[model samples]
Target: MFPIRDHNPSGRTPYITYTLMAVNILIFLSYVGLFSDERALSRFFFDYAAIPARIVTGDGALTLVSSMFLHGGWLHLGGNMLFLYIFGDNVEDEMGHGRFLGFYLASGIAAGMIHILSAPDSIVPVVGASGAIAGVMGAYLLLFPKARIDILLILIIIFRVFPIPAWIMLALWFGMQFIGGVGSDPNAGGVAYWAHAGGFIAGILLTIPLWLRLGGPGFWRRTDGHPPHPEARYSTSRIPKVRR
Candidate 1:
């Protein structure tokens, strides 16, 4: 499923989130052409992406930060950006631009550490902002649990857009990452489930102070677990019809 939009609107502009998305896309496109040269791509990943073993030995420390800007492929970049785009703005609005940027980086670095712990010996270079974006999802789940998100579901040829509570979507995502991390071997490269899970948990914890400052459970009551503003309404009739 893919989330197309959220009902809640941010109180302020999410400049930091937008900047992050731009930087990640720019960095990925900078070296995407090397995909045809397997060796070059591998070398590039090793140098710029997060390698668990290299991290454990105090080497390639820069990758903990650099890797957050790199991605595996077009789909990888797209998916991560989509998630970040969906949930990041609200958190960024709540935290303010400067703090949000710092929070994003901190969450990503923490995620990298968790991934390294999961596979200290694996040489597979970790890429993508999923772990960091997972952090945003975690915070969003806590900050606006009752907000509605429109998710596009695809089953064979049957397609539908369903609106569901933010908590449900974010919780399900976290559960998947947790289960995947436990069931899969980190030494084998694919999804860095542990990193996603760790980042998500970290995001929640890191946002606790802000949550408290906003009055904790009282904040929930004030906004009813949604952004404190009017939701934007779009007309479905505006959609264009396609025919063969």
Candidate 2:
């Protein structure tokens, strides 16, 4: 299942979210050609991506931040940007642009650290905004658990778009990451599952203060566990129904 959008809308413009998307896209374009040349790409990743082994050696500290802006490929960039696009706006609306930017960076940094800890000796270089976006997902769960998310699911040749509660999707995503982290070795270097999980936990903890400031359970009671605004509506998909 892939999330296409959310029913909740932010009251204010999400400049930070838009800007982040642009920056990530631009950065990926700058280096995407390197993918055609494996050695060059490897060098680029080592220099700019978060290398767990380098991090533990007290070097490449700056890469923890830089790496969040990088991605392994087109799909990597697109997937991360899409999630950020879907969930980030409302979070930014709640946190304000400046604070939201800080929260994003902090979560990403924490995620990189957790990845480093997961495989301190691994020389593989990891790059993506997933960890940070995972943070946004985490906060979205805490802030708007009942919000509706429209996800596109494809089975064989079947295609369908369905809406589900935000909590279900986010919780499932988190659980998959946690389980993946337990099953895989970061040294093998595919998905940074630990980073995703760590960033998610960090995001929730980081948002707790804001949650409390907004009135904690009182806020939930007031908003009824959804975005603190009217829900947006979309026309139903044109896919024909299956004949029974």
Candidate 3:
């Protein structure tokens, strides 16, 4: 199951979120040509992506931020952008533009550091905005736990959309990350589960102050863990068949 959209809508335009998506897309496009050449791609990732071993040796420190914008492939970019598109607006709406950008970057940096600590000797390059996007998911969970999210569930040939609380989806996602992190080798160079998990925790922690300022548990009581705006309702359109 993957989230297709959320019921909650932000009151204002989410300029920062849109800008972020555009920047990521543009950066990914710049490297699209390198994918066909294995050696060239490897060199590109090595130079820009975050490699734990290189960080451990006190080098490539800037990659912690750079790698967040670098994705492994089109699917990588699409998935991350989708999540950011679905959930990022509300978070940015709550935190305002400048603060949200800072929160995103800080969470990403925290994620990279955690990943480096998890596999300090691993030479494989880690790249993607997943870690940072995981942070946005974390914030969304805390701020709008009861918000309805529409998920597209595919089973064989059956395709259906189901609406569920945000907490359930995010909780399941977080649980899977932990399980995957434990089951896989940190040196294997696959999904950076730890980074995702770390960014999630960091986002929650960073958002705590804002949550408390809004009245902590009282905030939940006021909004009932949903966005402080009218919820959007969706309807399915039916196609009419022509009589032959």
Candidate 4:
């Protein structure tokens, strides 16, 4: 299950978040056609995607930032964008445009470094905004633990959308990454679990000062772990049961 949206919305317009989404989308579109040719696609990723082994050799240092804007496929791009859209706004609103952008890029770089540490010899190319978006998720969890998030659950023909506390969802997601990181070999990666986990941890660490500036635990006591603004309410949707 994944979040469809959140009940808490930011008070200000998240221009930086929207701009980030646009840039990621446009960059993915610009290179998506290369998928038609395996060699061409591989070459493209080699030039732009973060490779742990390349990083160890003191090369492709820039790909850590460039790779945040690249995606493996439509679904990969869509999922990361969805997450950023949901959690990014409030974090951006809290950080403001300039600081949030800096935080995001820093998270991505930290994530890449963690991945390199996990598999310095691996040649696999990592791409996607997930590492950066994971940072936003990290920040969101710290700032709004009690916020309501609607999760879309799919079980074959059964489809459902249900609201749950953000803490439950975010904690569960972080746990999954930890489990995956422990169980999978980083060199033979399908998912960069370490990067996700590292980025999430980094996001939280980076946001701590801001949280303290807003009053730390006292802030939570004041807002009850919700956004310091009115929470949005959404209507639930259900799929009609098919009669046999």
Model 3 / residue 206 / CA error / Å: 0.7
Query: Which lDDT values do the candidates have, in the order given?
Result: 0.89, 0.92, 0.94, 0.93
Candidate 2: residue 223 Cα off by (Å): 0.6
Per-model tally of clashing residue pairs = 0, 0, 0, 0
Against the correct fold, how does model 4 do in TM-score?
0.98
Clashing pairs in 1: none
- Per residue, candidate 3 scores C-alpha lDDT tens digits across 90-109 of 99999999999999999999
List, residue by residue over 1-244, the lDDT tens digit for candidate 2: 8999999889999999999999999999998888889999888998999998888889999999999999987788889999999999999999999999999999999898999889999999989998898888899999988899998989987888989999999999999999999999999989999999999998998999999999999988999889987899898665787787
Which parts of model 4 have CA positions greater than 4 angstroms off? none
Cα lDDT of candidate 3 equals 0.94
Model 2 ranges off by over 4 Å? 241-244
Best by TM-score: 4
Model 4, 1-244: lDDT tens digits are 9799998889999999999999999998898899999999999999999999998999989999999999999999999999999999999988999999999999999988998999999999999888898899999999999988999999987799999999999999999999999999999969999999999999999999999999999999999998887977677888887889
Off by over 4 Å in 1: 236-244
* Residue clash pairs of candidate 4: none
Select the stronger candidate by TM-score from 1 and 4: 4
Each candidate structure's TM-score, on Cα atoms with residue i matched to residue i, is 0.95, 0.97, 0.96, 0.98
Q: What global local distance difference test value does model 2 have? A: 0.92
Q: On residues 1-244, what C-alpha lDDT tens digit does candidate 1 reach at each position? A: 7788898778777889889999998988899899999999999998999999888898899999999999988999999998998899899989989999898998999899999989999999999898888888888988899998988888886677778899988888889899999999999999999999999998999999999999999999999999776887854422245678
